[model samples]
Target: MSPAPWDSEPRAQGPTGPCGLQFRPRMDMAKLEEARLFIQSMDYRRTTWQDDDGDTILHIYTAKGQREYAFAAAERLQELGRLDSKEHKGKTALLVAVTANQPEIVQDLLSLGADISMCDIKGQTALHLAATYGFPEVMQVRGRERMPLSTCLTPLHCAVISHGATMKAPTSVQGRHTWLVSLCQLVLSLISQEIKSNKTALHLAVKDGNIQLVHFFLKQPLPDMQAFINMKAHGHTALHMAAGLHTSLHQEDIIRLLLTRGADPSVRNLENDQPAHLLQSGEQGEKVRRGRGTSLVGECS
Candidate 1:
C-alpha cells in the first residue's frame, strides 16, 4: 500500500507568504512520483483531500509546478465534475496556475475546459490578475487566439493601469504596451470598454501621462477611431483629461495628439466643461488651447 504524500508530518504548502507564490524549495521528484502513482490509481480518499485552506490536490499540485501530477489530478477532478472547484478564498486551480506563473499548466487547464471567467474573492479573474501583476506569461497564452474578453473592467484597462504602476525601463514599458495593444486588437470590439467612473483604457493612459500608450490606442486601425478618441468617462474625454493635466511637456503633446485624432474640444463633460475650458492657465496651456481651436476649425473646413 502506497502512503499518501501528506501522510508524513509537516505537509508542504504550495503557496505561502505575502506573494502567495513563494513555493517551497524545488519540488521533490521522489514525492512527485509518489503523487503520480497515487493519482493514477484514482483512489478517491487519497486524491481528493483538501487542506485547511480548502485547496484540493489539484490546487496544490498546480501551485507546486508538478505538471504531470497536476494534469492527472485535474483530469480526475473533471471526471468528478469539480475541475473548477474553488478554495476557501475562491481561487480555482487555474487561478493557482496563474499565480504560480506556470504558463504551460494554465494553457493545459484551459484546454481541459477550465472556466476562464472564474474570479477570486476580490473579483479578480485570471485575466485581471495577469493584467494586474503584469504576468505576460499568462497573457500571451490566451493572446495566441481571439481570446474572449469579459469582466467589468476589460483586460486593456488592467494592462494600462499595470503599465503605469511599474517603473521599468522605457523600452521594456514600450514592449509591454505593444503587447497590450496586440492583445486589444484581437478583441477590438471591447477595446474601448469602460470601468469605474466609466473610464476606458484610453482615459487611463492619458491620466497617467503615458503618451506612448495614448499614441498606441489612437494609432490602431480600429473601425471607429473617431468615437474611441472622443469616448467619455463621467463626461470626460481623453482630451479633457489631457487638457486638465498640471501643465507638463507631455500634457500639451497629449492635447495636440487627441485633437489631431479628432477629439472634440467643444464636447462638454457633466460639468459642462469642454476640453479647452479645462486647460491650465500658462503659456503651454494657452498654446494647447489655441491648438484645440485650430484643429476644430480644420475639421469644420
Candidate 2:
C-alpha cells in the first residue's frame, strides 16, 4: 500500500526481512512505538531472527539510531552472549553504530561491553571506520574511553590515506586536515607506525604531495624528529619522495620543510641515490639542492 514514514530518510532504510518489514527510523514516533512493542514482544531466546543480510534486531536498531531501544537490546544481547554479534558483512552492532554516525549509540554499545576490537570483513576496526569516515566525535569517544590504538593500519594511517577534497573544508566545520592534525596531536606515539611497504603516515602524505600533512608531522615534538622525517619506504625517505615529485605545486615546499627539519640529504636509497640526486634539473630543483647542500654542510660541520 503506502511506504512507511521513516522510509523517506536515507539512514532509515535497513535490511528487509522475509516479511518485507523494515526497521523504524529515529523521529518517527508512530513507527517507533510499533518497533518498541515489537521489541518488547520479541523472545530474547530466539536471537536468530535476522534479515536477508544476517542483521539481527540489535543491528537494525543501532543502524537506525534508535538509541533507547538499541541500548536496551544491547544490554539484553550482552547478557545473552550476543552483544558483539556480526551481520553478514562481519560488522558488529558497534561497527554499525559508527557507520550510522550514532555516536550516542556507539558510547552505549561500548559501555554494554561491545567488542571494540571487532573489525569488518575488510579487517577495519571501529576506530578505522571512524577515522576513514571523518567522524571525529566517534574518535574522541574512543579516546575518552582510553581505547587502545593498535590496529594494523592504525587510525592515523587511515585518516591520512582517506583524506581528500571533501575533508578539506574549513576548520570550524571539522575539515579533514584539521581532523587529521587533531588525531596526530592525540596519538603522537602512533604517528611513526608504518603500514605495508614500511610507509609511515609521513611517507603517505609526502607521496600524496600533501604539504600541510608533511608540515604537521615534521612539527610534532617527537623525541627523535630526524629519524621520523627520514623514515624509509622501500629504501626511500620522505625527502626522497619529495625530491622525486616535480608536478605538485607543493613539491618545493615539501622538500624545503623536509630539509630544514633534519632530513638527511646525504642519506641514500636502495640504489644509493640521495634525495638531491633524485631532484629534477632547473630552477626549482636547484633551489632544493642548494637547501639540501646547506643542510648537509651544517650537519657536517
Candidate 3:
C-alpha cells in the first residue's frame, strides 16, 4: 500500500500559529500500518517520538482516527501508568477525543481511566468542551457519571449560551415534550449552580434574548424560587438583561415571562436602576413596564 498524507514529514507548526510544533497529519491505512510496525519494533515504553507540542504517539494516533493504532498505544501507555498524560495544552487523550468528537476513542480513554474532570489552562473540563461545542454524546460519557453540580456549571452555561434560540421541540408527540422537559430540567439544575462570574444560564439566555431558552428555564419546577427569579450577575437580573437588550425584538415577551415566573422588576441593580428603568423612553417600553407592574400585582394578589 502507498503512504498516506500522514506518512509525510510532520509540519513545522500547527494551524493555530507558528509555535514550531509538529503533529501527525491526516492518516490512512498505510501510515497506520507503518506506525503500528514502528511501535512493535521499538521499546514502545521508552520511545522518544513525541511531537514538539508534547503529544505522545497515543495522542497523535487518537486524534488522527487511527483507532486500532490509538487503542494499542493507549493500552500500553495505561499499563505504563500514563493514560492520563497531557499534551502541551494540558489536554488529556480524553479531552482531545471529546474535542475531536471521537466517541469510540473517548470511550476507550475513559475505560482506560483517563480523568474526565481534568481542566485545561482555561479551567475548562471535558464536559465544558462538550457543552460548548454542543456534543451531547460526549456529555453522556461514563466518566462523567455522578459529576458534581459545581463542575457542571460551566457546561450548562455553555449549553445555554451556545444554543440560544436555536433549540426547539417538535410538536410531533408526547415523547418530544417529555424529552424537552427533561432537557429543561437539566438546564435549570445547572443554572442554579453558580459560576466564576456568578451568572446563571438563565441570565445568559435572557442577555442573548433567547426567548425559547428563557421560557424553558422559567417553566421548570425550581427549588429556590427567590434565588432563581432574583439571581443577579454583575448586579443585573435576567429581567434587567432582557429589558436592557436594545436589539431584542422579543424583549417584551421575555420581560413578561420573568415577571410571571416571580422575577421582581422593582429590585435594583448596583446602579440602583430597576428593570423598568432599563427600558427605552418610548410607548413600547412604557407599555411593557406597565404590563409588568400589573402582572406583579396580580401574582402578589
Highest lDDT against the true fold, candidate: 1
104, model 2: CA deviation in Å? 0.5
lDDT of each: 0.72, 0.71, 0.65
For candidate 1, the lDDT comes to 0.72
Clashing pairs in 1: none
Cα RMSD (angstroms) for every candidate in the order listed: 6.1, 6.8, 8.1
Residue 269, candidate 1: C-alpha displacement in angstroms: 2.0
lDDT of 2 by residue, 1-301 (tens): 3332322333444554322333333445564565556556667554445667877778887877666667667766777788888899999999998887776678878877888888889888888788787776666667655445555687788888877543553334334556676676665463466656788988888999987778877777888888888878899998889888978888878877887888888788999888777777887666756654333322211
Task: Tell me how far the alpha carbon of residue 169 in candidate 2 is from the true structure, in angstroms, after superposition.
Answer: 5.6
lDDT of 1 by residue, 1-301 (tens): 4444733424444655322333343455676676656777867765677777888888987877776577778878888888998999899999998877777678878889898888888787887777776666577777544444456777677778877664462336655765675556544453466655788888888998988788877887777888888888888888889877874568877877887888887788898877767776766555665664333322211
Worst lDDT run of 10 residues, candidate 1, spans 292-301
lDDT of 3 by residue, 1-301 (tens): 3332233434222233111112233334564575557566657444434566867777877676556567667777777778778889988888888777666677777777777778876677876776665554455544325433345355677667667322442223343234334444444463454556688878888888888778877776777766787988889888888888767788888887887778886788898887767776777666765774323322211
Model 3, which residues run further than 4 Å from truth?
1-38, 45-48, 143-153, 164-188, 191-193, 291-301
In terms of lDDT, the poorest run of 10 residues in model 2 is 292-301
Q: How far is candidate 3 from the true structure (C-alpha RMSD, Å)?
A: 8.1
Candidate order (TM-score): 2, 1, 3
* Residue-pair clash count for candidate 2: 1
